[model samples]
Target: MSFFTRKKQQNSSDASLVLASLGGDRDAFCIIVARYQSLLCSVAYSSVGDVKHSEDIAQETFVEAWKKLETLQDPEKLKSWLCGILRFKVSRYRRKAASQPIEGAEDITEGEDHEAGQIGLEESAIREQEQALLWQTLEQIPANYREPLVLFYREHHSVAHVASALDLSEEVVKQRLSRGRKLLEKAMVTFVEDTLAKSAPSLAFTTSVIAAINLASPPVQAATLGAGAAKAGSLLKWTGLVTLLAAFSGVISAFFGVRAGLAQSRTQRERRSVIVLTSLFFIFAIIFVAGMFGFKHLAAQHIVSPTLLAVISQLWVLGFVFSYLWLTMYLLQKTRNLRAQERIFNPDAFTHPADSPSAKQREFKSNASLFGVPLFHFRFGTPEKNDGPVVGWVAGGDRAYGLLFAWGGIAVAPISVGIVAVGGLSIGAVGIGVLGIGTVGIGFVGFGAAALGYKAYASMSAMGWESAFSGGFSIAKDAAIGSYAFAQQVNNEQAADIVQLALFGQGYLWLLGTIAALVIVPAAWHSREVRRRMKR
Candidate 1:
């Protein structure tokens, strides 16, 4: 067999062995662990910067893998699975480190030395000396550069695997590796120059050590050895499945909304509101879809040339900056609303919860006025009891929901076209068409389900079922406390209002439903709205 074929067969055999282990074969598991332990330990060592911690982390990873073996749908994906777990452990360590006070480099260096001692070194004394020097050089490099280099060379992972482990893009991983190599070379050169300047007795030995380190350094290969292509294909398949699920859910939500809208009596105000919102949703959806299609087309044709790519990158950064700004504004608005509610209900409210003596001891402080209202207050209390519905009437009324529906439509549109283009009149065409139809059909079902839930909440509120239930419950309680004026209970009307508010609160979700409704609903509300508005 060819080398590549042999490699594939070996990998397949390894997977079978792992599966056998999962089926209560301990020896098989030991063999699998023995094969992979060194690589896993190296990756953990790089991430944690201490050999002992790395080995401990590696052991924990194996334990976790053992526990989760049944959940492994594909034993071949074990490497990625293990790496993901190790990355998570490293992240947790980093977070813990960040929270603690900083320690000196001496402390870190000493800790690393102590950990390295745990791995008994019975090697030739000269070889041991060389390895120690190499480790020292590695420690000198910055954490970012060191981690990637170690993962690339020691673990022998592909650019994609490394990127996934670090939660970065493939391009970013490539860039980091390139930069890291340059830095490592520079550091080695510096070490040599400094050693020469000191005129140390071990100058000859140091020179040989530097040469040996360079020779021993692993070469940077183009791709990961064996199974990288298969892993990518598997990942893409899963992504497609998720996209299909999302599309189905969106359609189901939209169906019920449309039915509820149609069932409403021919009232001018109700009809006008529905008509306007629906029209706006459709217009935005179309625009969003068009933009997405254009973007994809540009990407495919290499029309996103170098200059265009740079511009797009800059725009992406700008978009993130603006998004952060908008998020901050939204948070501030929410805070203001909360403060306003607090003041309206009780001006002299306690600054902290009644249960907290420490907080109560703190004096209430009021800040200067803004627009005749205090901007800040130390005193706080249970906020005003809002008499409005528990859920907002406009919960799902945002333009963003429509935007999401439009985006989802755009995504679905491509798949639809692809199916038709590839499967035209072939025997397999029927299957493709059925899949497309079923996918869209299921999406509509999900939309309808969500809308039905919303309509129920609205209908229950309007019919005063909430108040009736509350009154009936009140009668069953002891007459003494029930008759007391201070005894307050929520009526059915209030309960229904709460439900209605919650139902509508997430308007963006409806857009997801609308996307689903496109295939499921007789006619999508957004589409119908688009046609109605076009007439005007």
Candidate 2:
């Protein structure tokens, strides 16, 4: 595993250096950083035409290289890989720079105009002016020619070093340098070469790169989500589940209570009171969920602290649960009192034939059964259909209940869809399930316009205790990507990549593709069955 000693690693082959680095020899990687530092800086300078930024970019390249070293399948081409990373870094930096407003040089020198600082100010101004002129001249030279010229000077005027670094012949390197010098003004030629040579990253650069690598968190290996991230994700999932359960239970209780009030024995006042109770229950639930959403939005904008949002979330769950319990108990007592009346239920209410008048009058009803469960059952709303709740293997209506699939205004099944949907795989305007997709969704994995989950992807707003990717705003404990994002890890692509890894482990794409195939094939078959039933 120790392919070379510290002294020998300086002259080690790229493959040997890589193997050694992978085997936990920091010296081998440090050697790599030192060996390629000048080449990277020169290449970056050719693109950005700024010495400081070029150095910063080069340092960033090394860090990225360290993190992604194992991804290099061909270690003999380490130089090419490093250059590729440098190019990506440069392009990203350019994009970020383009999005920001350029500050005036006056702003930089504003506070340093004191008599005591006059000498420092004058030197700084002159240095900045020379740098600006050098960059202007460098920009005139083409990239192909400019690259060799920069590398040649920065690598101590060695044509062979430039050639090897650029993967060109020594003669080609000499040719480009000659042309690059000719492209620059005679006065600027000497200045450019002197500046490049002097600005070549020193030994301190290698040390800093090593320090950065050592200080940074280790790259995620073949591992699941981190313990803290997983715990955070679980917390979020449970909180949402609790709220959803409360909503479901409260709504169901209200529905049954109102239905029970329709008994002939119940007074008109009691019936009206039950309806009022249902209305109040719905209003309170809506306000609770809406208030939570509003507070979360405020938290994303930093108008409220995340700590306050967390406290409110806990309180929201508690409040909903308590309110639901109170509603349920009140409904239960009302039901008990109503049942005690002598003039109980209507005899016709208990009679439901297969072709009942209510069933025939439905907006759309199809109960094509497979085994005990109906394979396809489509109706209209939550109002008494077939004198009772519609149940099916694949159901759809205003309210649908299915053994396998369901879709309507309110749906619940293994896979469900509606305006308000809940199931293992749920999709609707507001969806809550293990995997959910909707305008507002909450699940283990959620995707929507506004979403909350362990791994959430949203068009506008997202909050994932583990990770979140959003077009507008995002907040996460571990990784995040968005226009306005807050997380421990914020690199857009890297954060997304981490979420993928967390979701499906190492070879996630293959797993995701296979999952898609499995789901789609079965879903297609089910759709054909549903269509056949519709045709009849």
Candidate 3:
């Protein structure tokens, strides 16, 4: 059967069902309840103003209807009779409310003037900050007349229908809605005056939300972005930047053909590779350095948010330092090969330089000792005669005594320190030493990305002697926190702390990303190439 046809038949039989119920037919009484129960409940809600109470009223009205069925003069007016009973119940409820003593009535509007002033002060405090706050005004209607107002125009000024809906007299409904309109001017003026007294663009994050209900304008917005939009933008900017750094660094690592080389073993291609590698270093270095320096007109517009600045500031700076590390490693190879030409230097694995007129080589003889450590002293041999190693001194007296210490030098030895150095125990921009210290250190006691030390700190990844603080993948015996962290005692994170979650998630995500970039993909590619070569 069609739904509309069923509905039509039900409506047509309502009058017949009312008659049957009046004649004491139980099945007909059930039909009448089913036919009008929802309508009664809705009408009851408008009167009692409580959904649950209105439901109770509907049940009472139904019980009374069954009892008084014989008293209903027109069986067709059965729905109307039920509605009349609902009005009596609502009237009793309102009278009961009026007799009760109101409690804590003064607290709702206390200290209103103080809250008004706070809105402006908060905005001023957060102006220089990255917060972008905006306020919105709402329509003000009179409270005194709200109870009397019955959705008038929509109901077309029909007093009977309005009174029935509100369970009020037709006269009262007409009087209240009319008086409410008359006070509209006074209500609007008071609302506007209160708002004007308190409104200002100066709002803090908390006050901004409250002030947003009335008076709001954009805060001294950073990057022309609102709070939500800027957060999204900064998130994208950071993710893209870190990902690019990893990709470019991996590309440079691959292109340089990871191998150890001496001056004689170096081909012309290898020397040129130094130039190419240096250029690659500058490419990533410029991006990170620019962010630090605040290249406003460029892609480094990340300074708009201070929190992003602190996090990304570390990122780019580390990138710059890492680039220097690659350069240091490359130059260390070159320096070792060139230095061998000057003196008998021990190198287990060697990469000879390109074939130059170096069958005959001159060795600079100089050495110094510091802190019982020997230092090799020599000058850079010149761009034309760039064959001399970058090392300054060598401990040829006791070859066991190894130290490439100077103002700054790259040491291939176990212990070294230049202004920028690399060795087992070294200090420089990239500290690839056993116990090293630098801007972006990496070693047993290092302080940089993937840093491991007795006391180590890195933004992305850190493993310490006891406890480490990192963005992700951290391990410490005393305490640790990252995206994936393990610690023995005293963790600062709680189940509800969002900052901890973000840091931990970020660390693990980037670590997985870096591993994919440097190890997994390269290994897979190498494996595929090996298989292909064997097939050939």
Q: Per-candidate TM vs. native?
A: 0.27, 0.40, 0.29
Candidate 1 weakest lDDT stretch, 10 residues: 478-487
lDDT of 2 by residue, 390-412 (tens): 57887754356989977644578
lDDT for model 3: 0.42
Per residue, candidate 3 scores C-alpha lDDT tens digits across 1-536 of: 12342243355444444432332233345545655554565455445443345555666666666665545555546667777886787777667656752522232123233434666646544431211111111113343244334234324446676566456788887777677666556535344333322321121322322222213221110121111111111222333344445345444433432321212233344456546654555565456534544522221132243333434544555566666766655655654455444333433222223222341122223445566433543321212234434343352110112444332334445654332445776543455677664435566655544456664455444556665544433456666533334455322222112112233333535643543343224323333332332221
| Model 3 residue 281 lDDT score | 50
Top TM-score hit: 2
TM-score for candidate 2: 0.40
Worst 10 residues of 3 by lDDT: 218-227
Q: Residue 525, candidate 1: how far off, in angstroms?
A: 64
Superposing every Cα of model 3 onto the true structure, what RMSD results?
A: 26.3
Tens digit per residue, CA lDDT, model 1, 1-536:
12342243245444544433332233344445655565566677666555445666676666666655555555656777777887798787767766763653455556556646765444333334544565676777777776666666543447776676566788988988888767666657455334222321122332332233223321111111133211211211222332454445434434543443433312344345445544544443344334434543453244664234323422432343243335333433433354455445654442333313233321222345445433322212111223121111111111111111111111211222111111111000000222222111111111110011111111000111121111001111111000000011221122223322223223534543443443344224433432332221
* Higher-TM-score candidate of 2 and 3: 2
Model 2: which ten-residue window has the lowest total lDDT? 222-231
Which candidate wins on lDDT?
2
lDDT of 3 at 77: 62
